[model samples]
Target: MADLIKRIQQGERITITNRDAPVADLVPSASGTEQQTLDAIAAIKNARAGTITHAEFVAMHAKGRR
Candidate 1:
């Protein structure tokens, strides 16, 4: 588990097993704020929708910075 935490610190994924059965995954640590989690979930939902064109996404991101 210590090694898994080290790997997560280095932005690597880890898997956890209980009694030799795969039960969980350890991913890189997030800031763990509610807004951050919500934003990640929203991004995932948008990605799974798969309706946006590449150009549209680029434009939207660019506009966000302005």
Candidate 2:
């Protein structure tokens, strides 16, 4: 646990495994940075099913304000 904390403080990504199978990952919490948003968009694009365009994303944001 101490080692995990140490590595995390150093901005390292850590994967936790059990019996050689990954159970979870320990990543730094996002702070609303632009890179984080881009990474999120990439993840959404890689989703195994549907997609929404940039226009759709903007429309959804606008809709929530009404």
Candidate 3:
């Protein structure tokens, strides 16, 4: 369960399955205060050297998992 939460925190969506069929999805919560959202955006902007498209972000994440 801890590992699953960690994966969700790392931006991976998890599907909960039952009988080999998808029953539910365990995804990160989108709910946050406005200040929190702004803080997160600011933090991200500060962390990166330049902008990246969503595809590039996904690719980078995949590469890091390897």
Q: Pick the lDDT winner.
A: 3
TM-score for each prediction? 0.36, 0.41, 0.52
| lDDT (tens digit, per residue) of candidate 1 on 1-66 | 687777776567777899999999988756644565686577657767986678866775675464
What digit string (tens of lDDT, one per residue) describes model 3 on residues 1-66?
999988887668999999999999988777633555686576468449567777766765675574
Best by TM-score: 3
Residue 21 displacement in candidate 1 (angstroms) = 2.8
TM-score, ranked from best to worst: 3, 2, 1
Sort by lDDT, best first: 3, 1, 2
Error of 2 at 21 (Å): 0.5
Q: Please say which candidate is ahead in lDDT: 1 or 3.
A: 3
lDDT value for model 3: 0.73
Worst 10-residue lDDT window for candidate 3 reads 31-40
**Model 2: per-residue Cα lDDT over 1-66, one tens digit each:** 898887775568899899999999997666634565686666567543457667766765674464
